[model samples]
Target chain A: MTTAVRVAWLAAALSLTLLLCALSISIGSRSIAVLDVWGFLLRPEETAEAAVVTQLRVPRTLIAVVVGAALAVAGSLMQSLTRNPLADPGILGINAGASLAVVIAVAVTGIASIMFYMWFAFLGAAAAAVGVYLLGSGRRRTATPARLALAGVAITAALTALVQTIILTNQEAFNEFRFWTAGSLEGRGLEITGAAAPFVAAGLLLALLLAPALNALALGEQTGAALGVRVRRTRALTFLAVTLLCGAGTAAVGPIAFVGLGVPFLARAAVGPDQRWSVPLCLLLGPAMLLAADVAGRVVIAPQEVQAGIITALVGAPLFITIVRRRRIEAL
Target chain B: MTAAEMPTHQARLAARRLSVGYDSRKVLDGIAVEIPNNTFSVIVGPNACGKSTLVKALARVLRIQSGEVLLDGSPLSQYTPKEVARRLGMLPQAPHVPDGILVEDLVARGRYPHQGLFRQWSQEDADAVDTALRRARVEQLRDRLLTELSGGQRQRVWIAMALAQMTPLLLLDEPTTFLDISHQVEVLNLCRRLQREGTTVVAVLHDLNLAFRYADHVIVMRSGGIVAQGPPREVISAELIEKVFDLSCRIIEDPETGTPLVIPQNPDTAAKGS
Candidate 1:
């Protein structure tokens, strides 16, 4: 593809993402028009429409965009680091780690504040990633994709079991945990978004800076090393970046499923495997996917709403199966 | 040449009492050798004889367990990775190629060491990539995806990438693996041309005859020790082949190049012919 064409596609993707953001703010439970949302934005007062827009929809929309982009970029980095197309925070036990940490924090201390959950989630995500890395690299040879995936499966299973044990034992904790586990963008406010924004922003910055090295890494470890890339350092930094991304996003909105797994495939398909291009595209495509799912969830049951996590699973599972069934899935 | 004058063609890469192993199982033990500047040096050995291990050590992919590897009279560890890469380039056996990457983009990546955080994609990088593609005869395939190329074409593209690094010294581990006879010869010829153009080349080769034909200096090994090192005529003999490979063979001269060629003597055929 020509440079002109690629730039044009990127522009189109950006425009679509902006459109989704607008839709997310406008078409919630109240069904406000775009023009009305614009008018409300211009004049902030005690009007119910303005309150709904500023207090409710705007924070949710901002969180959606931030978390969506974070998960997608993290997914791309994970896939490249492990050279496994199936590697994602949700699939690789990272979300389970954060979820388990949150459950434990609430069950043990009975603190239901978002700040506590965010800190615990960050620590748990980092620990889980390190656990997975150690387990994968424990093999006699360098870690293969299958080995890393197996490690992820094992960690996910163990963490989920622990989470279930905690939630099943305490009824009150279960009530709070169930809502968070379902992964909805509703009822969240600016406080949650503000708490997670710095982490997501740092992760996004680190990922973009690491793009060139990630491209070399796609050529395999020894090859990347030969090309003057510091393989071990890059891998370490990638883990830190992924931790910040998955932890903060999960903490703010609670483990929304499939955005991390599905967005990278779409990004790679749209713009080839070069991380320089694919990573940025993932930033846009991820939010678009999440917001679209969130909007669909709101409208699917007019009086009530399906969670965004459920909707993403509904859409993402089939896409995942299709990718696997293809004759050749790109390895990195 | 006089003995004093010979020092002018000094070895740029030399290992002294080098030891390498993985997880306490030593693969190479106390080995010493020198790769002279501007020569096509080939290291040949039987399977599992530490040929790949030695090359890996030389390329800094494997850390030395003991002793030191010196590049241009300085210890390899003294230089930063980018500094070392600016002087030495390596092409590993069966390096991964990311899917859907254009050939030109792959070659341009060899400029990584030359590029800094702020210094990116300059005119010099473009010229180096262009020169590498033309030299490797893959310019026409520059815009094509790497997955679409044939095996030989892919190998040449990889070579083009290495060439774009523009290092004075190059190391290859079995560059001709998995290719047909004609393609193997083509790659070897390219290595020969690179040597002629003053890049010091070192490679690990399986084919003894091809090594003899192309190598200006040859190192034969058995069980992690150098068995012989010199020009092919001085180093390759029937006795050395039998000792190193455990295969009885008769050494003959190539009709076209007069390089040493090995004709293995099968026990059954040898008895019947006699």
Candidate 2:
């Protein structure tokens, strides 16, 4: 794609995202009209729906935006860092890291506050990332994608085994683990968004800052180094940004499995290879996609909503397959 | 113009007692050579003779074992990577261009060394990139994806990227490695044209005839050290080609260009006296 076309596509995606975010707030279970939702937002005294708008739907929509953007940007960064189109938060084991941490917190300590679990989730993700980095680096400064991937898989397997073992030993924890691991936005409070917001914001900031260096890195280490990018520093910084974004998103939305992978992949297809524009497009397009999925999930059963994670997986899987069939993988 | 009045064309790039290798296998040992500024220099030797290694060491991609590479008599290692990159640009044998990368964006990356943290796109960068694209004859291809171009066109794009660096010295390792004869001449002509624009270019060439025709200064290497280096008239002799390349060649002049032409004797008939 030409640079001008990419810029235009990104702008269009951004505007569409703004519309979707508003639609998400108004299209909840009670089905408030768009005008009434806007009126409630503008003037609290207008309707009885104001409280539900403020208390439930708005916070839910905000969580969707933040989490979706975080996951998508994180996925884009990971794919570039690993130079693997298949790399994503779920596939590369970051979501598994958060899941293990949340499982231990809920199963072992019976920590009920979602706010507190955010901390453990971030820590667990960081530990998993460091494990992967160290194991992959293993005497080499830069690890190959294949090696990093293997290490992530190995760590994920071990942590997943531990989670299953914990669940087997204590069936009491199974009830809590079942809902969270299945991935939903149900029963999540506003405080959860507040808890995970700072980390995701910080991660987004790091991502934008690292985008230029990451663009240089796409040309491979020798070319990137010759172009004066500090290749090792760039790689390390990209890893940190991916970890923080994916970790915090997982904390917010309970390991929304393929959103991180799928959104960025779609954004790249839309915007082409330059990360400077692609990252921002990923941020906007991610939530637009997730909210659309969320709405689809809400309407799929008429009343009984499928989990947003399940909906994303359902939609994302076919879209991914279509991408694999239609576009050459090398184009990524 | 007097040397003093000239636009600082002399870039004294040299390596002092440079030794470089991987682990215990020393590829180059105690190698020393001074590169003259504002001239087309070619490093030529047989395979594994450390010509490419020397270029890498000079480019600072490979770490020196004992000595230091110096730019303007200051140790090259002492300069920051960006600082070194500001004055010296390098093109490895084959640079990978990601699919769908636009020619303009790839060229814009050359401004990385000069760009500040907060600066995204500046006028200086745009001008440099524009000039580079024009110089490399890739202005039309600037909007085209690299994957869509032919090999010769893509090579020009890579050269445009290095040219966008606006560095005084450019180092290329085997820039013509995978080109046909016509494309090879096209690339060599591009390098010579770059030298005409006041950029000092050093390239590694496997083709001795092309090297002799294009290079103002030629350095022949044998077993990791300089066998001969000077103007091609002095360096591209039959004896040097045989000793350096282990090939029996007769040195003749290109009638039209007055450059040294190497005519290699057929292998079957070579060394009939022996």
Candidate 3:
């Protein structure tokens, strides 16, 4: 597609996402009119409706947007780095690593707060990424897609086993672990968003800087190197970016499944495989998908909300399958 | 300008006692050679004779274990990757093409070395891409997806991408691999055209006859070292073929081009005839 057309599409997508964000903020357990929501947003007051909008819905919406974009962009980078369409934080053991760490924090410190567990999650995610890289690359060999995928599977299985053992041994920790594992975007305040923002921002900035190199990398490592890309350096930075994005997102919202796996395919379908276009598209589309799903979670049960993670899985699984079946998955 | 006006264009590529290897085994050991400017040079040898390794070393894709590759009288390692890429481009054997990538976009990626952090997609990039597409004869297929093109057309598009690099030197490893005879000729003809336009072209070729017909200089290798290096007509002979390939062969002149052609003799057939 032409650049002008792509820019037009991006603009349309951004507008639609903004509309969805408004809908998410206005329509919750208590439905407020769009005008009232805007009035409250524009003018501060001590009214109950204003409090709901400012203290509750606004923080939730912001967290959803940030976490959603982080996961989606991280997923896209993972797929491009591994050259595997199926790659994501969940698939690559990143989320499992975070889950294990969060479980351990709860069991050891007896602190069930999401805020406190966030740090451990980031540490676990970074460690898992490094482990995967070392195992996949091995001695004297760069990580190929097949090798990376296999390494991810091994790490994920091991981490899941450890997490299960911790939860099973401690009944008190299991309750918190169960809720966190379901991946809800609830009860999180602006503090969580503030804490995760810098990491996510840094990751997004690095991703934008590396997009062109990632595009060349999709051609192959040797081809990327020949194109003047520092292949080893790009790979290292990509791992760091994915770590920051996924670590922060997983910490803010519990291991939200499928957003990272499914969103990139949608972005790639819209903008082709050029990372420069696809990564930005994912940034916008991811928040849109997450906010829309969060809205659905709030309304589907009316008065009682399902977690946003469940809604995304319900929507994302069939879409992912359709994509895989509709076209032959290209070999990396 | 004409070739006589320029006289000898300084050698842009040279290797000094370079050694390269993978894992623990050495592939090319202490071999040195220089590629003359504006010449279509072909490296040929039997399977696993390190012809590709030497090409890879020259392109800086393979790290030299000893000595250095010199570009314009400076060591290759001293220059940044983008600096080297600005002057040299390499087309690896069987490069992967991303699914659903348009031809023009793939060709445009070759401008990566010239693009900067803040400056990208300039008019010069556009012009280079256009010239490359026209020169490689893929302008008509620029909008098509790479997967949709035929083998010959795809190879030409890849050449167009390398051409878009706008480098003085180009190295291709088995550029004609997996193509039919006609497509092989088509790619070779494209390389010839590129050489004519003053691009130094070096390729690792399996077909000795094709190398002889197309290459201005031929480097023959055996067991990680140069067996002979000269103009194809002077260097290619029955003795060289037998020594390099471990096969008895008769060297005959081609009727069309008068380049040496090796026709291997089967020992059983020779004994029966005698």
lDDT per residue (tens digit) for residues B75-143 in model 1: 888977777778888888878877677899899888888988898779999999999999888999999
Native-structure RMSD, model 2? 3.5
Count of steric clashes across candidates, in order: 0, 0, 0
Interface C-alpha RMSD, model 1: 1.3
Model 2 regions lying over 4 Å from their true place = A1-7, A33-36, A43-50, A134-140, A146-158, B1-10, B255-258, B270-272
- On the 0 to 100 scale, the lDDT of residue A18 in model 2 is 86
Error of 3 at A292 (Å): 1.1
Write model 2 residue lDDT over B116-144, tens digit each, in one string: 67777889999999999999989998888
Native interface contact recovery, model 2: 0.59
lDDT of 1 by residue, A1-332 (tens): 56676777679889999999988888877877788898887888788989999888898898899989999999999988888888999878899999999999998899888888999999889989988888988856467777888999999999999998888889775787788888888888888989999999999999988988888777777777777888789999999999999999999888888899999888877777778788898899889998999989988898689989899999999989998898387776
Which has the higher TM-score value, candidate number 1 or candidate number 2? Answer: 1
- Model 1 regions lying over 4 Å from their true place: A139-141, B1-9, B269-274
Worst lDDT 10-window in candidate 3 chain B: B1-10
The lDDT of each candidate is: 0.87, 0.82, 0.89
Candidate 1 local distance difference test against the native = 0.87
**Predicted structure with the largest lDDT when compared to the true one:** 3
Worst 10-residue lDDT window for candidate 2 chain A reads: A323-332
**Each model's DockQ score:** 0.70, 0.53, 0.68
For candidate 1 chain B, which ten residues in a row score worst on lDDT? Answer: B1-10
Q: Which residue runs does candidate 3 get wrong by more than 4 Å?
A: B1-9
